[model samples]
Target chain A: MVTTAAQKPILLSGNEAVALGALAAGVRFYAGYPITPSTEIAEVLAVELPKIGGKFIQMEDEIASMGAVIGASLAGSKSLTATSGPGFSLMQEHIGYAAMAEVPCVIVDVMRGGPSTGLPTKTSQADIMQAKYGSHGDYPSFALMPNSVLECYTLTIKAFNFSEKYRVPVILLSDEVIGHMRERVVLPDPATLEIINRKAPTEPREWYRHYPDKTTGIAPMASFGEGYRYHVTGLTHEEHGFDATSQEVAKLLEKFKNKEIRNTKELTMCESFCMEDAEICIFAAGSVARSARQAVRILREKGVKAGLLRPQLVWPFPKMPVEEVYDQVRFILVPEMNVGQLRKEVERLRTNMRVKVKGLNVLNSVMITAEQVVERVLQIDFRSGSESEGGTSNG
Target chain B: MADATNQTAEPVDRHSWLRGNKKFPHMWCPGCGLGTLLNTVIRVFVAKGYDKNETVVISGIGCTGRIPVYVDCNTLHTAHGRALTFATGVKLAKPNLKVIVFMGDGDAVAIGGNHFIHAARRNIDITAVVVNNSTYGMTGGQHSPTTPLGMKAPTAVTGNIDPPFDICNLAVAAGATFVARSTIFHYQQTFRLLSEALEHKGFSVLEVVSHCHTSFGRINKLGSHLDMLKQQRDHAVVFTPELDVEKARAEGKDLVIGLLKKDATRPEYCDQYEKLVIQPSQAKQNRGGV
Candidate 1:
């Protein structure tokens, strides 16, 4: 959508909306490479960032882009980069570095079909597991899924907030459909949005620890010129950020997971539609959630009790919402663009909940449609006799 | 200056650039030239009166890459061959800060060659101190882009027939405003070149031809560390305008140990970005336009 000077609600693609979201969130530096689907974000940013007194750089490759974003973030700038699956795979090492060094940066992965660049311009939620555990070590990551153009704007802002508040790299897991689909979006005024800036070190230099092992698992960050001179590395280190190759140092990683990841409450975001007094729920994320919402509406019209639960925060996977809605629904149908990546997680986390977790997967970069979702939900034969028992994941 | 060859005395604390006693008994091997190079870097910092708060030291993976960790400045030890990329980010984001990258031959020219060339071409205001050890020392002395012809390495079990890269020539060709080559054997000259490179307001590269006695030396039969230093002193000739590259190589003096390029008039990247991005926006705002 071509944004005119008029300030009314304008049509915008998810990529354009995301770039606007970064501007609204006070991002001052963006480094990225051109990749399909996600490339629009970089293009929009390249034009818009300069207008807002921000910087944009097209790096040589995705790995360098990620590294540059992390570096800019460490220099006290809210920085970001956007890429697709192949580029996202190249960024995994630096993603780990950002996690280890506790840099506040945002990575927008407009996921496309992949294992090795499978689909250049098609949608897929195939990067779900890669986003969680692609890096070598165990470190916390915050990945958000936006199901609509408006959510792409709002959740990108939220991703920046999560990055600043947690001092960890946040991944905005978008898909090709949402990235390219044009929709009319009413953007909130930048002043009205809640922007969270990273906390600076209040303590003096002598007492400051870059990674303080506290209950909250968050420490104030100081940029390069802020006089908080410190060492940052990818190696497992102590609280002060020095290489400590000891068993004790490795044990400290538990606190990083518990405090920043598990203990945090507000970081997890999920939305449910038509879930009240429903017998079955379709679980989805990213672009597929849009289909699930329409599928639920279709099922509701037919007097078949079905609902949709969409997890906006895919990582630190909001299991509580799923658990809360677990007993209320008899079956949870997980539909994905991949071979049931999220379905496995749903099964793993829904251990004690006596719900039948099933998967409706469409590979080859094909999106799962609303009709297919409705058919899958309607195919629940009553005579099967508790086939939903034994929480084995079905693809 | 203090005896450049004296490896016994700890100079980091003496110069007040060392972090703390905890980082002492440094990670460099015995008779390693990284310590001397680090001492020269400290001298440059002190000599130039650079505030510690305004300096950011970045390095990539290798023995030379570990130099930033021991420094008391805001140091970042990045992934292999990506230090320049990170330093570019730092300089572009915070134009006031002095960004310096420490990289090894493999980190600078082999895997990271693309980034190095682009950084030079972009002419970002960052000083790159490339330690040309002619081999990938940290990864067991694999052949690097700077390895001389017929040199033996782990990856090249037979003699390496690949020609070596002249780092200064590459940087100059890629539009670096300041380029210099010096060796650890010529400590005073290396220190002088570092000082000049740090003062230059554009992309500058100070290539330090140092000896990697552990891997490169062991494989190539380049004698002890002292013998390598003697060889450097014997072969390295001061770079001059009239010197012919062919003649220098013919005399077993391929190392041109002096300033090879300096173009102060060329525009720097960060300044250009500010002029191109911020100035126009500010001008519009000043004229009462949104």
Candidate 2:
């Protein structure tokens, strides 16, 4: 994993890489409560941010930290907060508010095992479902998971960009493995980064609608006092940001749900390896993506034409791209840290295609190894007979 | 009373900047003092020429929480008891914006009590107008932190054994830069006190004794909104600069109407944050641009 010195490489932990990413992306305000596997984010920012003329506040609790970050963002500062599972649960209400209010901010959930403080230092991807449905009510949220320390830096920057561009809270979903693991990350100069600020109103203040037309999907966000005095609430609201309690408002609310993720299929990113002519395609993300990649490589060595579809953007659930791959493959094998959470989504979308979706779920503390994934891929009953049976049919 | 007649009658010639949907008059019960407090806030906003665009009115869930929906400012109707938390975000995101929070007794002193105190302790630049009706008015008048002792409410059928909190005293103790208490009946005093609170640079709390005709009124046999207003008027006492803590305490359970404390020396949370985060050149950089 070594690179030339000209690449501006630095050895850093996942938390450090995240901090560096935020700093490089022009995040000037950070408010977070310290929690295991995520405390280093706040600790590092507390010292590094201040030196770089950024404000860092260690709030009394996770709720206040979320509140502070939201406040800082509304005040026209690029702001962020970091927390783990339990803290993420506490932040759900506000997170929903961020979605409804269209506030641009990043939330880094350095996940540890938990329904309630299960393993504070240990890793778990149990929050995958929570990230999608944790907040009550119907709304769309963006979540990105990074497997390595380098991806931690890259994805955090992406999180900020997505948040600002979409004007919604984007979750940088990292786990204990990446948050604690140290590796080399080549830091990009600030000038090389693409930072997206929220779109501002082109119309007059009086005419501006906080939630504009569904075409752009993103409305112009006028900061307070910029003359576009509009309303923002967690309730079902009209385009003007006023509380709208009518059938029309309900329709608009549905649009709010769809426009963010629906037609914009390109925003969904995933990595595919050896899928050009494969019979079995394994789907996975985050740490499991690493194992799936390795499994695909091992299967290729064993003369099995298996491929991997590793989603970088875990939600808006890559359904279309996944279905496209499903059309070409005889079987889809999905592996996850949790027990078949993503498998459910895949099965649902692949229904019309009649693709056989099998899941390799590892609920225990151990990571899903490449060997296990390869074994599972080989066992899949694709039209091409099982790899162990030495069948030559590519169907 | 003196200022009330003059200020209301000779209304400031400001634009009717309030964009609140009139169809939804308010969620507060008839005769609720929150209406009076809201009117006073509107008046202050008008008088000060505060641009509706720059003013953000945030409210938590409760009867009082509905106040922001009726205002024409950039409003945020946040989750229950989390207005301070959300308002903290709005204020920090736009430090130049004038942010205010409206909360009920329960929203401020019960579920949101921690945030209330911490926001004050940090001296965040936001005005919190706590409409203290002494019970959880929205949830059918459950006993709250401010529900008077021996008050018969649904949650306290045998009468509330717990002592009530003097919210103004609590705010003063928690380091609020400005603290005041006023009742709806004292229109002039309430308006003036709220105006001062809004104008204050640091965290300010104006705990207004509001009437909840539906719940608190029914149980206490407070007759009606008129009767409750009169009761508050009768029970309130004016505090002077010469009044000591002992003297104020001796007035006991009565609404002490006056600015209890003012500490302009404390640095506002936003000012401190700006100093820490914004570089000299960066501060001068155009907002919403790279």
Candidate 3:
């Protein structure tokens, strides 16, 4: 049912909203293998993309699906692939390859409960750390988390934009609950959205170096068959894409890892609700952010002045905003679907603040509900709190 | 075979396109069969009049994988066992371009065996020249899938127990439109087979038994590059018009040089996909009167 013009609008599942968002974003190629919760995305793209002159390939496996998307992207097509926990695990090596090669593409991980195949259709935020550290070696990656279908639609578009802007693989870390559940979302016209295209080289073919110009952090990428001869590899390479084994070259490549991300500070978007006046703040992302939001309102009505800090851009950690909220709030509460994944980051930065930081960790099939978060926040006794003292609850 | 032999046999000029870099003078070791096989591929490409820019060469990880880097073309040196997969993408993405895969026996037969079978089964418009050097020469003389039984390699000191795969037979069984086998010592014969494979409309595999002067030579006591080449020449038996698969297998000899099978019944991968994907889009465009 549609709400008033200002209130929550139409109802849609997170996966359906993402499909619509990709369609609106002019996604022409979708190559994915069927996996739990994320399979709806491939099914939808298969039916919808062909109507728009786009192509969808259900590849033999996750490895080939990832390869197909990379190939499609090289051929001047905006492509994406979606998978769950195990499939995402299979794609880790190539994800590193994409990062090293600076290929612009989007990967959607509808995270299921797992170290292996914990829960195929069940939801968990356990993959938060995996998404960051799963791929071997040191390289920067962008991850976006959406707590609702509306954000799922908007953030997926943002994912594509960030992929193009930074010229690196961007991940939309949506969980099974957010991916499968229905909610209200609005589909805006394509013209209203700000689309980012990759920066093409202005220099002539002979003068162009593929990985040159470390000043901007991102080198201009030339598509194949464009008369500009360049090399790309999974190895640590020089400006010409040849294998470079020197320490100085390694340092130069490492500089790119930080520069590409540091330039896109505006892309780091977050929302703070009643955090300015609250003594207790709840930090969350993805579906748990919804529970945190509701918990804040419930605590506020009870005169506790509790607030919620939702990170839209999970990577780069949103450190500045968290540090800003750290000054105003005496107690920080983190509720996650997994066991204390993102809580470690919050605790590391909570030094000398004398704040009672607590984590509401859960790994079973159940999600962290608003009532559970509220109960955890209320149980934190400010009178007995100390620098060394902390609380944890397996909800 | 009749039509291929009847075609003009102009001696291919190899010097004009050769890049003169003495430091990397023939990156392949002297008398390595890959050098001779590579010379044949280059000559065939020239004879077919393929522009260097329009040709795409893909290779997997091995000594032979370096073939694409030396060639002046749109080249991709992909990860192990993924050259055919990458070539599939390259050809499907850009249907007009001519895609070729230069892979070694271990690269194509061991790790990339699945991709090889699938590419042939689909009959994609691509040519794969597999340089079968018997052993995994680049990584030391290890026993590969194509290494003959009783062959003493570093990994198989007791002699390899695994039976060798007849790659041409496998390719023909997997539905390749053109399947052929040749040796590096037979330079003209190798060139002729490669030229025909390139001209074939569907997936074509040309298995060239090349000499590995470093690993195989050291193990088998074949001292020099010339000695190794002589061994390949001695072991290889040319298939004739009178021989069939049963007759060839019954002879207890590995039929080395000649086309094994040529069939054009099945449709190519791209042509089938285009009919299913691109044709409808074209129809809609026509209806819109664009």
Among the numbered candidates, top lDDT falls to: 1
- The TM-score ranking, best first, is 1, 3, 2
Residues A117-214 of candidate 3: C-alpha lDDT, one tens digit per residue: 88998999988887787788877778899888988888888988888767778889999999999965666655677777778889987677777747
Docking class of 1: medium
Tens digit per residue, CA lDDT, model 2, A116-217? 978888877888889899998877778899988888888899999888887889898898888888886676656677878777678876677888756446
TM-scores of chain B, in order: 0.93, 0.88, 0.88
Q: Is candidate 1 or candidate 3 better by TM-score?
A: 1
**DockQ, per-model, please?**
0.67, 0.46, 0.35
Cα error, residue B197 of model 2, in Å, equals 2.4
Where model 3 places Cα greater than 4 Å from the true spot, the runs are A1-11, A245-248, A351-353, A382-392, B1-27, B240-252, B281-290
Worst 10 residues of 1 chain A by lDDT: A386-395
Identify the candidate with maximal TM-score: 1
Off by over 4 Å in 1: A1-7, A245-248, A352-354, A364-366, A381-395, B1-14, B284-290
User: For model 3, which pairs clash?
Assistant: A10-A184, A12-A183
Better of 2 and 3 by lDDT: 2
**Cα deviation of B120, candidate 2, in Å:** 1.5
Instruction: Report the CAPRI category for model 3.
Output: acceptable
